[model samples]
Target: MREALCQMIERLVREEPGNRFPGEGGPYFTEPLIGFAAADDPLFTQYQTVIGPFHLTPTELAQHETPPWQPATVICWALPISEETRRSNRTETIYPSRAWALTRQHGEAFNSALRRQVVQFLVDAGYQAFAPQLHPAWREYPDSPVGIASSWSERHAAYAAGLGTFSLNDALITPRGIAHRLGSVVTDLAIEPSARPWRDHRSNCLWYREGSCGACIGRCPVGALSKEGHDKAICRGYVYGAVPEAVGAEYGVTSTGCGLCQTKVPCEGRIPAGKVSPLAVKPPEGESPSP
Candidate 1:
């Protein structure tokens, strides 16, 4: 099933017309990384507090089926943005580039279609599948203490699926890096969960592992990111607020994004080597070494 699903994702990125940019004729997502986890994984239950109380467990989601379901598994995938798009945004200091804005807005539409397609494929194969993001129950509550959080966090699911870990910027740092998006589906098939290589959620991050490399903090144009972590309200205001007001009118899109922290950094496309020693380079004044 994993191999089949991998092939399906490859085909979608390579052959799907909808995944292509309007005039560039290139794919929005370069390639995708897929992982699996048991439906009853305890981490899902833990996510209720980690994300929000509204988060649903696999069993709770399965109950929505016409006939109650049993044990299941979750298939999660990460879609890395194309280098061209990342490069475009990396060159900007204040607002998102046109490519970045389009990817964040239209690219999500493609992601939704991909989710629907995957669910349909699983159902057609005699298995009951559900995409929590696509479910009616899915909801997003802004301005939470934990930044802008949602009921079902695709990045958290991807982490449990062994796709990657969280970075200081709060983006999922997969093998392909933080400039990407994630999606997942829950199904009745009990597939084996992927191996989680790290002991802690932030183990893969250089800032957490070695207390060095706080490039993301410098990349934040609005000063939303500091040694403590990211300031969600400020970041959101810049991306969803100032960005659209400044560039949305010209781009013909309402939704805007800024991924400066994710690019022009060592961890943009892949994990960096061992951490830099604190003695070699000290963090900016007033900023701590901790991520």
Candidate 2:
């Protein structure tokens, strides 16, 4: 099942001509990494606290269906932005490079298509499956326990599936790195959960380990990031506000991206080469992690 899932993703990102960015450009994303998890994983339930109580668990999301599919597995995958796209974005100081903007606009569209195809593939195989983000009840919450959050977080879903861990920049640092997009599906077909090698949730992040390498912090144009961490309000204000005004027409994409922090960093394409900082085990006992 894992091999089949891997092939499905690779074929789409590689052979699908539509996978390319708009205009005469390189592919939006490259080699994909897939992972699986039992829908009943306890980590999903714990996200109610970490992300917000409003975040939906797999069973909760599955219940939204007609007869309610009995979800047994959660399939997750990471689509790394193609090197061509990342290279372009890495050169920019503020606004995302044109290629990066197009990737965010078109690349995400490809992700949505991928989700639909995965669901359709499972259904054709006589198994019930669906993408949570596509569900009608799926929504973003502005008044949740977390500042601004959504009903189901794909990053958290990937984490539970053992695809990656959280980073100081708030992006999931998968083995392939932090510069990628994630998608997942819930199905009745069961598969063995992927192995999670790290000891802590933020173990893959260099900053979290030894309080060193705040590379992403320097990349932020709005000072949204700091040694303390990311400021959702500051980051969102720029992404949803300034981006539309400053980059709207210039890039031919609106409110799509500014992933400066995700590029030109140690963890951009792979786990940073270094020793772990014992301090990054987890937030001190009383402090909760920001979504």
Candidate 3:
């Protein structure tokens, strides 16, 4: 069943634009059932210890924190960075070939299409889906917890969904590789979730091992990411500062801003590098691929 579902997801994503990244692409799909019931539950507190801390910190806006009680599932649909996007943005030049770049021109549109498709898929599958940002930061707003902002990190959703583990630079990497955009839907429905793949740090990609590779940490124009982890101030400042220039120049308009991280990881290109896609999933039964 897992392989069947994996094949279906991989096929759909391979046919889409801007999903392939650098190394390989997975039709990797996860249903994080645990997150869905995490709100107000002690059972999940221990789960957090296992999965690692949620990215929210005290410095973040009150509306952006992950709610202690909002138990939701995440579905990730990703692609590779395109050569044209890379050339246009000089991502290859900037990162020195560690990551792949997607043409900024198509990045936003492509991401939107993927997000919509995922939401639609969830609805069709009999689950309630929301952008997370649309919901209140928490059930109580007067004295919300730290980093309790309205916009939750899709990255957390990706992580909880078992898409990948965190790198020193704070980016998630799949078995396929890193450099992907993530979108998620929080739902109350109980669905089967993806099994945890990485037992510990040992199973993660080798580039993460200290001193072995620092493409992500070193590539940052600002020294935001490091051996300790991401410096949120440095990261926010750089990304926020870059957005105006990127928008003025009509570069990729992903709300998350500059994709320098995506450009530096050596993975399969977002689009298929070869004639075949590494992880294209076939449609279920007689159903055809969604447009």
Candidate 4:
């Protein structure tokens, strides 16, 4: 069942037409990395406290099925941004490149479709399944006391599934790197859980691990990152505020989010194994930062 499911995901991404970028830039996401966790993992409950008391566990959400079915597994995937798109965004100073913005828009529509497709696949296989992020009861709390948070966090699910760890900039540092989209599904399929390889949530992060390589801090155009870590509200305000009004409006970008910190940094393409990459930020000469 696990092998078949992984093949299904691989084929879906390989054959899905919706995975491409606008204007002939090719695929929006490379092949995704899949992982799984037991639905009853204790970490799910832990998220409720860390994210909020209202967060739902996979078993909790699965119980809402008509028969109050309990899920046995949580399947997760990381859709790494394509090399072309990441390269386009790497040189960006103020606005995300057109490729990046449109991908954030249309590419996410593809991600939503992928979620629906995964759910459908599990259902067709005679199992109960649903994407937590797509559930009607799912909710977001941009103004939460913890700063921008949600009732269910995909990043957290990815972490539990052993796909990645949290970074100082508050992004997941997956094996495929930080510039990626994450999604998950809860299902009755009884698949064995993947291994959690790290010692803790911040293990993959360069800053938190060795106390060096803070390149991502300077990559934030808005200074939303620092040694103290990310200011989620400030980051949110800029991505949801100035970005849309600026490049998104004039440059034909769809709704936009700035991920400059995710590119041209040490952890951009891979985990920095005990040493920072030479790709750490250094702007082109005389280029002024966005205001």
Candidate 5:
């Protein structure tokens, strides 16, 4: 079943025009591996441990098979490449204007179609289909005991799934090494998870994996990411004050977030060869604010 599912994912990726890597990337690639999940997998515990304060909605009790039912099935890891992925080309134009440009370029129509195809494939094969729930990371309120929206860090998931580990800049390092946008999907149907987690490989990149790259720490105009790590308070202060306009300029809109670490990290040079397509970002004056 796992092998078949993996094959199906590869097929969907290859055929979906929208799935094409940014440029005319020849083909979408998949690792020669799959991950399995048991209800009791230690990975879940590890996920919580690594992420610190976050929550997972109760998937077990939330199952309602009635209409409008959208139960999650598989935990998928997705990497979306943005302008930050390419450092060799440092022109401001190199970065994508939007965070979800890769997914949005295909249009909702194509994304829906592709999702349906994959979901149907899973269901027909007797596996329940599911979608990823973005775990809580940044919210306006303090952390709560109840399951919050945020899950473990995307980087942590990749690392736990054995895709890669955390860099000093706090990015996950995959063989591709570049920080493509990443997401996951959790489902009800059980399957064998990957035996060799990304942690085993470890990132060879000096910036993220090796903890050497601190460019982002200094580049943060507001000092959100500092020598000690992310200073949420300092960052938020700017978001709510005089720098609000500048924040919007950097990130696209006036939101209380930043990506200084993500953009200036080491993996910028390690974009995967699998991604051959050219990404498009809006032309900007110099640098944009972080999200």
Candidate 6:
């Protein structure tokens, strides 16, 4: 099932034209990395404190369809932005590049469609599946201390699924780095949970570990980031305010995005080498590092 899901994502990115850059003519996302977690994983409960009490559990979500007795699995994935998009955003100091703005808008359209496709696939396979983000009950509390937090955080789900860890910018730093988007589906499929290689949630981030790389802090033109961490309100305002307008004027599309912090950093496309904690074990020969 894991192989099948991975193949499906690869095919979707390769075949979906909407995943392509508007005029740059390339896929918005490279191949995605997928992972799984037990729906009842205690981590989900901990997230309630970290995110909010409003966070939904898989069993709660499963009750929306199947009976509560049914077991569930959460499938999460990291969709890394293409090098083209990453490169373009890296060149910008303040706002996102036109290519990135378009990718942010259109790429998300593809992501939404992909979520539906995955859910349908599971349903067709005789399992009850739902994307919490797609649920009518889904909502975001933008005023939360974290800023723009949702009932179902894809980054958190991805972490539970062993996809990645949180970065200084609060972006999920997968093996493919922070230049990526994430998605998830909760289902009664009961797939084995992926192994989380790191012990701590912020283990993969260099800034959180060695405190040596704060490139993302400098990348924020609005000073939304600092040694203390990110100021989500300021960052959100910049991305949702003047940045989109400028990008729209240049690209002829009103798309809001400012990923300057995600690119031109040590963790842009891969885990920063030599930054892993001393206690972290190297991957066995012939195996790729966890994402």
Give candidates' CA RMSD values in order: 5.6, 2.9, 11.1, 7.6, 10.6, 4.3
Number of the top TM-score candidate: 2
Residues 30-56 of candidate 6 have per-residue lDDT tens digits of 888899999998888777777777777
List, residue by residue over 201-289, the lDDT tens digit for candidate 1: 67567887688889999989899988788788898888888989999989989987788898888889987777442121321232211
TM-score for each predicted model, relative to the true structure: 0.91, 0.93, 0.56, 0.92, 0.58, 0.91
Per-model clash counts, in order, read 0, 1, 50, 0, 35, 1
lDDT of 3 by residue, 1-291 (tens): 334334445555556535444346422222111212222223233333333344232122223434333334444434444444443334432322222223332444555555566556666766555544334442322222422222345555554555655555556656545555555555444446654444432224344332345556666766776766567666665565554444533333344355565554453232112232223243112211100
Compose the digit string of candidate 5's lDDT tens values, residues 48-133.
44444342322431343333243333444544343432432232322233333323334233434544665567778776664433
Q: State model 6's lDDT.
A: 0.80
Model 2 agreement with the true structure over 112-227: per-residue lDDT tens digits? 99999999988888899999889887999876655678998899888777777788889998888899989998999989888766657777888876677999999999999998
Clashing pairs in 1: none
Runs off by more than 4 Å, candidate 2: 277-290
Model 6: clashing residue pairs? 163-291
Off by over 4 Å in 1: 143-145, 275-291
**What local lDDT score does residue 141 receive in model 5, on the 0 to 100 scale?**
28
CA displacement after TM-score superposition, residue 50 of candidate 5 (Å): 4.6
lDDT of each: 0.80, 0.83, 0.43, 0.83, 0.43, 0.80
- Candidates, ranked, TM-score: 2, 4, 6, 1, 5, 3
